[model samples]
Target: MKKWREYERLVSALTAEEYDKEYTVIPNARIKGFISQRKRQLDVLVEYRFNSDLNRRIIFDAKDRKRPVDIKEVEAFEGLMKDVGARRGFLICSNGYTKSALRRAQEHIVIKLLSSDQIDDISIGSWDMCRSDSCGDGLIMWDLTPGIIIDGTVYIQATGKCDSCGKFHIWCWSCGNRICIDYESELQCSCKGPWFWLTSIEPDCDEIGEQYESHYLILVLGNGNYHIMDRRPI
Candidate 1:
């Protein structure tokens, strides 16, 4: 349990430090009063800072328990919310909470019950380029393998087939690579380089880890470079 709490603290500290441009997080802060005179040590303290005038405390309690938390646990967390004047309180438990506990939290707008599974799903991963034409330069082809490292980052690629066009597409699990299957047949890509054609995409989400897949349209926009365009997923 101590090790789990330490891990949670480490994760919280890393996240806060990484996103310091957007938020201000204070882990393990000791406070007194507001309701009780005893000093309360918060597991992780966070503040959502958007602008000069927008900021509020978001408190967290990391519990490394394996049993389902009961309604009484929810009530206790709510008490801390009222005492600390925090707009939100996250009770992150490892084994999840009971239905009655969730029902109890419904009455408190600031109280939220989150299991480790749910918290782990909270990711800030973003696409490099959302627009098809704005992908720009810095394009490179991958060997199409699980846990492939590009620029020192791990990436996983998967394949998919469109039902309407019967074309296969590839989706990278890490870097989000779009698979292409429009083999130019008798014509060349005009880039004067090897085709580097990609084929064989799987559809199952369990395969690629992403629900979306797209078709790529490779173009040669001068300078001996290839621009990959995509019909992205919505």
Candidate 2:
């Protein structure tokens, strides 16, 4: 599929730009698995240095399909991550993913489930102060302005980790309803809005150099758990 190859290239370009020159980003990489001792084809591969000069690898797989990625594919990706011995793996889909796949991703902390619609050139700004009572001076790192539609209502979302405590913060750009969580958890606005899941991938490169975050918005559906909609990044 030529279209799928183009989509994978776009994903590789976006990921490479995210890290800039700090890391080595390779497109269409074939890596040898430790356990299988076989070369596995990856859509994108990232190599970076961790603390104490330890080298770490990150892999990305782009899925282009008419329907959302299912739970079985997510499980296979997890196995690939382990086989490749990557510190983190990003599974980016053109459509979205099912609710069961999202739940499966939560079980593994290293697997990042993402929706690759388009790469946005968002300006990084402090949208609001941290809500943590203990850390009053800390600010939310980046402001994501894309609005997610739910139940015929458009709600702008802003989510980032606190600078001091590293707690994940989710906020509504319209009503200022926000909440802080320990990690990527489903959130509901106090304004009685619908529940939604926000997935973020922040590579552990803060100490070594620059760090970038990739976020995905998953819309909760009332029909069934077989399908879930993800916001298209603008």
Residue 121 in candidate 2 has what lDDT?
36
Residue lDDT tens for model 1, 1-234: 245644455445444544443344444555443567555676665544322111255677777777877789888888887776566777766776788888887743333445666646554222111122323321221122334343465534433323223233445453444643543322232333233333322221212122322223333323445433222111
Give the number of the best model, judged by lDDT.
Answer: 2
What does the lDDT read for residue 190 in candidate 2?
70
Per-model C-alpha RMSD: 18.8, 17.5
What would the TM-score be for candidate 1 when compared with the true structure? 0.42
lDDT of 1: 0.46
Candidate 2 local lDDT, 17-41, one digit each (tens): 6873435455566655656877778
Instruction: Enumerate residue pairs that collide in model 1.
Output: 159-201, 159-202, 160-201, 170-179
List candidate 1 segments past 4 Å from native: 10-22, 48-55, 107-234
Q: Best-fitting candidate, measured by TM-score?
A: 2
Report the alpha-carbon TM-score of model 2 versus the true structure: 0.46
Task: Identify the runs in model 2 with alpha carbons over 4 angstroms from their true place.
Answer: 49-55, 107-234
